[model samples]
Target: MVTVKMLKPYYVKTEEKYIRIILAYQYFSIIMNKKVYQFIPVKSTEVRINRKTKKIENIDDVFAFQKGKEVLTISMSQLVSIPGFLEMLHRIAESYYLPEDTEAVSDQQRALDQLISELEYENVRRLIDKAIDNGDKEAFLELTNTLNDK
Candidate 1:
């Protein structure tokens, strides 16, 4: 049977709070995606877990690297194993930001909005003209609201 051997506490600090996760694995691999970490070349870091429990240990030594960019260690025990890992990988693969979805946006709409934003004089007047021509009530209301806001 696989058991989680008690290790040191892992900490994560955010803007609002500091979270400590108790790591129980003696050995682990940090799996990273190219899209997520961005530019950092490590795909995985093989960590050698130290079992010494008497003294306060430096965070760097227990983790993977010696000098360069440190790998962010997420305990393998914290992650669900086998089928779950496969499922997570599948989800990441299917994500919207995976380059394929970016091409789906139509070029015509992008160019029109780009042109509209670049125009210096009375752009809203042009929009109002178009809205009036089309009899678009929603566009008219939005225009009125924007005018009121200014």
Candidate 2:
């Protein structure tokens, strides 16, 4: 009488060691007896994934959160019973580990580096103009020296 409706990470945080995925309404949903139910975490609902292996390392249940003090917890047992919960989590792990994302990040960083270089050059040019207009020989010589060193 139960069927999985949907399962996906609502929010994902990537770290140096692992990736943490949060499950909540719309993030993890199921249907039981024709009634849809969404999981809400009491204190912790983070699913920790191993970055290297792309496998789920931990799914923290309510009991694991701060000694299980809070109420309004999702049933971890029921979550496991969802038709494709584990499989979907694995798929998300794989998607997040794609090499293309790394390439895109590097490209963005290169763009930023170019922008910074252009701004520095513009600033130096303005300073050189100011030195010449003010007849400041010392500053003009220093500016030329600095540009040459670069």
Candidate 3:
């Protein structure tokens, strides 16, 4: 079994196209034969997170978590498979989407409005994905229309 041992982001880099999140230390570990092993990187690692989907856009970036010793390089698929990996990335990614650096109350309200809209959009989209996964065609069509109206 594989689980995230550590998921604290050391830094988050945001760009117009994508968001890059850097997490270090014992980010993930696996249990084999009743023995636990931590993710150890041989080199620096990075992943590009999609803003809308809140998922890893590609696995081309090198990544293996490191702590002290126990350096074991893992595959991109392995990293992606961790249960909370995407959710963790999404939590960090949302901050970038929300407006920042606002000074006035009116501006703040506008930012909050934008944040609410974005959150609603994301929630609808996520539901749509779940519906597709569950093969609920009715829900899919309704969600598509809702998104279209938005």
Clashing pairs in 1: none
Residue-by-residue lDDT tens digits, candidate 3, 23-105: 55565455544556655445645567765556677675555543356445666666677787667667767887635434677
Residue 142 of model 2, lDDT score: 96
lDDT of 1 by residue, 54-117 (tens): 1112234323211134445333343334234434323332322223234446676798777776
Which one wins on TM-score?
3
- The candidate 1 region of ten consecutive residues with least summed lDDT is 11-20
TM-score of 1: 0.20
What would the TM-scores of all predictions be?
0.20, 0.47, 0.50
lDDT of 1 at 106: 64
Q: Is candidate 1 or candidate 2 better by TM-score?
A: 2
lDDT of 2 by residue, 33-113 (tens): 566666555555777877767766654455121112432344455555567776777777775663546788999999999
Ranking by lDDT: 3, 2, 1
Give the TM-score (vs. native) of candidate 3: 0.50
Pick by lDDT: which candidate is best? Answer: 3
Which is superior by lDDT, 1 or 2?
Answer: 2
